[model samples]
Target: MAKKAVCIMSGGMDSTLAAYMLRAQGYEIVAVHFNYDQRTQQKELESFRAITARLGTGQTYEIDLDFFAAIGASALTDRSIDVPTGGIEAGVPVTYVPFRNGIFLSIAAAIAEKEGASVIGIGVVEEDSSGYPDCREAYIEAMQRAVNLGTRDETQLTIAMPLVHLKKEQIVAEALAYDVPLELTWSCYSDEAAACGVCDSCRLRLKGFELAGIPDPIPYRVKNGVS
Candidate 1:
């Protein structure tokens, strides 16, 4: 039997690519997506559903953690804050959803433990997020420590961040190499039908695919309300 892995699939480029990498490594992929009161949560989950079904993953799990609203100050959960443009060069941006990864990882780790999975997969890219310390190697390592110590299982929980050190362009190249369906993933911070290219997440995604010389399969509404 193939070793089991629980992939935290957010239906973004990085996480989708991470799933491909793990599948390439011969792990029985079990995708787990969260609906944590995020504005784009529903659309993102839909993307995951499509991608996982296309890939024929063993099973896909969807969990709703509505409790995240109580811990919400970030732009993703709270509508008051605007998603940042440019990058988050100025410390952590409003888009940095306040320990969001930590929350996701903790929940994923729990589910992995229940499923008898020793490895938990998350796709946090360092190059894509320069300002978020949570995406850094040090932070991931610390989280791993917490998971290990906090878990009751004898088997250690290993956090797998395959794209952690790669740039967005490199990630795109990797995704293409693995033949991942990029169109099935969504990365826009906006809740609209099409991506708002001006937002930080959309801009970075546009730049990544452009730099990698690949056509972005996801449709985008033209900037300034022009289709």
Candidate 2:
């Protein structure tokens, strides 16, 4: 039997590319997505389904955690705080979602344990990503250790962060090489109709594509000559 991997896909370029990388490595993908009532939850869910179909993976999970809205701390889940569109800031952005990756990984670990998967893949880019504390390599490694210690003795799962150290440009190049459906992915933190090109997520994605010398396949709402 082929090794099974639970890929924590967020319907974004990074996670989709990570899933494809695992598929290329001969692992049966069990794609997992979360709907935490974010601003672009519907759009993200749509992208997730489309990406999963393109991956041809039958095993998929869409878990909804409505607690994010109740918590209401981050800009993504809370409507009061505006998402930063000026530029990438120096420290952690308002859209960090307060230990979002850690929560997602814990849920992924549960899914992995239930599915008997040996690996849990998450696409967390440290270098070119929004400086979320949860996205750090050391934090993820610590979570992995904690997961193993908390799970059953027979269940040994490795958290695979294939894009941990990769730059956005490198990620874009690799995603194109793998023929990932970039058009089907969504990364905007605010707008759901069309990607707000000025937002941090959109800017980062666009910059990566620009640096890679490849045009982004997705449409963007031009803002201040950007897009």
Best of the candidates, TM-score: 2
Candidate 2 whole-model C-alpha lDDT, 0 to 1:
0.92
Question: Would you give me the overall lDDT of model 1?
Answer: 0.83
Global lDDT of each candidate: 0.83, 0.92
TM-score of each: 0.93, 0.97
Mind giving the per-residue lDDT tens digits that candidate 1 earns over 1-227? 56888899998889999888988888888899988888788789889999899777877899888877787788888877777655445577777777778988998888888888878889998767847778887899999999999988585988999998888889889998999999888998875588776677887787788889887888887442345
lDDT of 2 by residue, 47-75 (tens): 99999999987499999999999998899
Clashes of each: 0, 0
Can you give the lDDT of residue 38 in candidate 2? 97
* Worst lDDT 10-window in candidate 1: 218-227
RMSD of each: 2.0, 1.1
Candidate achieving the largest lDDT: 2
